[model samples]
Structure formats: structure tokens, C-alpha cells
Target: MNLVKRLKICVFTFALLFIGTAVNAQITNDITHEEAFTALLAAKKNAEDSNVLVNIAVVDAGANLKAFIRMDESYLGSIDVAIKKAKTARYFNMDTGKLGELTQPGGIIYNIELTNNGMVSFPGGLPIKNKDGKIIGAIGVSGGTIEQDRAIATVGAKSILE
Candidate 1:
């Protein structure tokens, strides 16, 4: 083959190889239920450090509740809100703030926030991802201020891989 033709063929082959690798690299591993509960308990302990009465909820990627806990004196009113927020995080694979954005007026995905059974459109929820970088679950915290809730959820989500 001529030099230019050979160079073109090599580049095309390299491009095809790159595309194949990219597609395979997208595979992911999911977190287990045990990891989800462990993360929740650890989060609870973290929140306890601040003397915050918090309710924590964990949900799987499919937005199904996996585990839940509320401090003995936590507000009952926050339980459902906490669970829903957790599920929302898992389903959307992001933090609760993004979920809020999705539900904001004029947001393209606004109506989706209303589809889940008990999703909360507020912060304090975070998606849980495994080593493979696939989000497999989420954590939510409530019974405190929104900031405190977000802090607790952050701790919980971080604990999953620790």
C-alpha cells in the first residue's frame, strides 16, 4: 500500500480500538445491601457527633428502600421525607441539590420529581457508588436543618467505600 493509504488505515484501526475500549469501560459494579446499611449506621454516628437528632434512609439504585434508621428522639415527620430523598438520590445518581434543580420551575425534568412515591426535592441526599464508579444506592438524612442533613448524608455516602 502507498504511505498515505497505510497511515490512514492505521488511524482508522486505532479509532476503532479506542471506541471498543470506551464501550467496555462503561461497565459497573453495584453496591450490596450490607454496604448500604453499614454506611447508614456510620452516618448516624457521624451525625451523633454533632448532637443532631437525625433520621437516615438508604435506598437501592432502583429507588427501593434498603435500610432506614432514626435516632430515638428524632422527629417522626422527617422519616418519610428522609426515605424519599434517599431514593431520589439513588434514582438520579446525584446529590439532592441536583434533584431540586430538576424540580425547579422551567427545569426540563421538573415533573419527574413528583413521580416517585416519597421523593424529597431538597438537599441532604447523596448517591452511593462502588469502586467501579457506578451509583448503586443513596443516603438521606433529615430531622435537622438542611445543612446538617446534607452533612450527615455526605458522611454516610463516604463511608460506603471506606
Candidate 2:
């Protein structure tokens, strides 16, 4: 082929490659098992530091339970709470506390928690986002006071960024 024709073809190929890469970058993937464990470990560490036994739940992009851990002496009743918290965060793409605020009486979305097979609109739930700002999963913690659960869940969710 002539030099000019070859140059044009090369440019076209390069453009196609660039477009493909951009599209791929925009595709958000689910949180892997390793990442889920990492988040669980980070959350466990936070609970230990706070001297609280808690149940932690991690859910993937689909809001399915990905991993879970119940610390020793943790409240058995907290198992479902933690799972529901994680699912609620993923279902709304916001923290449970924020959802709670929006669901309060006279709020725009009052009684929203009554849907989604029941959700926990309190604290202790946070959505996990990747470096590209895409939500990959969520983490929920329970068994401590609301403040402690929120702090621990935040730590777990943010750990995926590291």
C-alpha cells in the first residue's frame, strides 16, 4: 500500500483502540472475593480497636452478600441487620444513615425503607466505590452503638480504595 493509505489505516486503528479502552474503563466490575475479604478485615480491625464485637457484611455490585464475619461475642441478632444494611446501601447507592434521613416523617421519601424486602435505614451501612468513583459494593456493620457501627462501616468501605 501507498504511504498515505498506510498512514490513514494506522490512524484509524489507533482511534479504534483508544475508543475501546475508554469504553472498557467506563465498565464497572463487581467486587472480587479478595477485595471483600480486605474490607472485612479492615472493618474487623476497626471493631477491635473500638473494643466492640460486631457483625460485618459485604455485598457486591448486585447487592448480593459477598462476604460476612461475625466477631466473637457479637450480637446474634445483628447478623440479619448487617446484611440488610449492606443491601440497603447498595439498593439506594447511599449510606443507610443518609437514607434514614430522607425517610424520616415529612421527608421526600418517607417510608422508603418499607420496600426492598425491608431495609435498615439507620447507620452502619456504606457503599464501596472504586478509584474511578464507581460503586463496586457495600459494607454494613452492627453490634455497637450507631456511631461506632458507622465509623467501622466507613472504614471498611474506604479500604477498597487502598
Best by TM-score: 2
Model 1: which residue pairs collide?
none
Candidate 2 per-residue lDDT, tens place, 27-112, comes to: 35789899999999999999999899999999999899999999998999999999999999999999899899999999999998
lDDT of 2 at 142: 92
Backbone clash pairs for candidate 2 read: none
Candidate 2 ranges with C-alpha deviation above 4 Å: 1-28
lDDT of each: 0.85, 0.94
Instruction: Give each model a TM-score.
Output: 0.76, 0.82
Residue 29, candidate 1: C-alpha displacement in angstroms: 3.7
Q: Candidate 2 at 60: error in angstroms?
A: 0.2
